[model samples]
Target: MRARILSVKVGHVTGLREQKKQATRAALGAAALRLAWERGPENVRVDDIAEAAGVSTRTYNNYFSSREQAIVAAVIADRESRVAAAVVGRDADVGLGEAVIDAVAGQYEDEGGRDALLMITGSPALRACYIDTVAAIEDPLAEAIVERCPGVDTLTAQVLSAGVGAAVKVALRQWLRPTSMPGFVMVSGSVTDLLRTALTPLRPALEAAGDTEVSRCRL
Candidate 1:
């Protein structure tokens, strides 16, 4: 009884710690975005964001490596987990490729709005960070893939998720192309369409993995 009670206490403490960390991270990201929006991305410093979030600069560093990442995090808050959850929540009859593409496109289509998108595209550093954020979907998406397709191996799921990330980056680059004007980007066409097109080529691999049979699984 004592061991069980101790385990419960430990779990509660861990959950509380995680909640506090998440709150701090959200506060920092919000402060970063507000400061960047009010005083251009170039003018917003790490110290400024930390001060606004009521945390020490050292605490900010513990959460994000750069001001741009923190700012981007505000726009992309929980997107990775949401995308994974959407994919996992799809019907069992849905193909893995279709589910993944739909979930990614759906989440990204509603990400922030014109103002936030323009803010990210206006600054080269922020644009790079935004593109890099697509990679964050890999681990969670891989787990979702494994859950949705029982016969799939971890390595296969990981490769598929990485491929999806690469496709997303390509689509984002095409959508956020630079123009002749300095410090300005020309966003072209529909991002959802671009994402679907970029991800289409990976459908075969994804479907194959999803259809893998336990008897045919490699050692």
Candidate 2:
């Protein structure tokens, strides 16, 4: 009875710690974005972000590698987390290609997504950071892919996820380029169309790896 009570107490403490850490991280990212929007990326300093987040510069460094990463994190908000959740919530029978494509493309179907895209595309530095930020999705996505297809190896899942990341990078570069008129010109079609087209080459890999039979055979 004593051990059980202690265990519950420990679990509660750990949960609270995790929540606090997440709050700090979110605060730093939000501060970074707010500063960047007000002063532009080139002018926003690490100290400024730290001050706005109500933490020391050292604490800010603990959360992000650089100011750009923090800004990108703020810009992305929780969309990557949403993508992973969406993928995880899908029916087990859904093919990897369909699951991933839909999860990513579905994010852009909302008004908030459109605003993020416009904000990101308007600045070259932020756009580049946006492209780089997609890499953050690889690990969680690979884990989710492997969970849905347990027969698939971790390495294979990682490779497929990397391919997906690369496709997104390429597609965004094409879709967010600047025009002579100034500001970002939306490329000719929907971002969803561009993403799907970019992702088309990975269909074979996604299908084969996601197939239970193929996964088992390779194992």
Candidate 3:
């Protein structure tokens, strides 16, 4: 009983710590975005964001690597996990490919509107950071694929998720391509459409994995 109680107390403490960290991260991201929007990304320094968030510069460093990353985080906060959750939460009847593509496109469909999109695209540094964020989807997405397809091996799931990440990166890159004009980028097409087109090639692989027999494969 004492061991169980101690374990429970420890878990509670750990949960509280995680919550506090998330709150701090959110605060910092919000401050970074607000500052960037108001003063431009180039003018918003790490010190400025930290001071706005009421945390030390050291604390800000612990959460984010750059002002651009923090600003992007505010625009797409917890999006990676939400993508995975959406994939997992889909009805069993839905094809794995459709579910994944829909989840990704839907989550990103309304991210921050025209102002935020323009701000991110106008700066090369911010555009690079934004593109890099797509990689974060792999781990959670791998888990979701495995859950949705019990026969899928860890390695296979990881590979598929990596493919998905790659596709998303391509889509984002195309959508945010730079124009001939300096510091100007054209929004070429709808991001959702680009994502769908990019991901469509992977549908067969996803469906095959989903249809894999448990007897023929090891999870």
Candidate 4:
């Protein structure tokens, strides 16, 4: 009974610690985004972001490597994980390319994502940061890809995931550019359409993965 009680107490403590960390991370990301929106990414400093987040400068560094990461965190918070979940939850019959494109587009279908997309499109610094941050989704995506392509090597899964990430970045750039309008205005076409078009090149690879999965199942 005592050991069980002790285990429960330890679990509670760990959960609380995680909650605190998540709260601090969210606060920092929100502050960074707000500051960057109002004053531009170039003008925002780590101290300023920390103060805005109601945390110490050291705490800010503990969470993010740079101001760019902190600022972009607001835009990307929980999104990569969500994408991986979406990809994994998709029907087994669904093509991997279609699943990935749909999952990626699904992230931007909301009104809430509009402002962040606008800000990223408008600011050169933020755009660069956004492009780089897309790569962070690769690890989670690789996990999902591995699940679908169990017969393939880990390196193959990683490469396919990285390729998907690159396609997303390219599609976003293509969609955001040539708009001939300000950031506040809506860009043409659905993000889904852009992602589908950009990711079309990966259909062959995804088909191969599906074939591999089918072969493994047969075996």
Judging by TM-score against the true structure, name the best candidate. 3
Error of 4 at 185 (Å): 12
Q: What is the C-alpha lDDT of each candidate?
A: 0.90, 0.80, 0.90, 0.79
Candidate 1 lDDT score relative to the true structure: 0.90
Q: Kindly report which residue pairs in candidate 4 clash with one another.
A: none
Candidate 3 local lDDT, 1-219, one digit each (tens): 999999999999999999999999999999999999889899999999999999999999999999999999998889999999999889867878788889888888878777888888889999999999999999999998888777788999999999999999999999999899998988987899999999999999987787667613222
* lDDT (tens digit, per residue) of candidate 1 on 175-200: 99999999899898999999999999
lDDT of 2 by residue, 92-208 (tens): 667778888888777656424565566666777777777788888888888878777778899998999899989988888787766888655666578778889999889888888
What TM value does model 4 have? 0.79
Instruction: Mark the regions of model 3 whose C-alpha exceeds 4 Å error after superposition.
Output: 215-219
Candidate 4 lDDT by residue in tens digits, 1-219: 999999999999999999999999999999998998899777999999999989999888899988888878887878888888888788867877677777877875652377777777677666677777778789998887777656666787799888988898888777666444554334557777887888889978866775763425111
lDDT value, residue 63 of candidate 3: 96
Clashing pairs in 2: none
Q: Which is the winner by TM-score between candidate 1 and candidate 4?
A: 1
Q: After superposition, how far is residue 99 of candidate 2 from its true place, in Å?
A: 1.0
TM-score on alpha carbons, each prediction:
0.94, 0.82, 0.95, 0.79
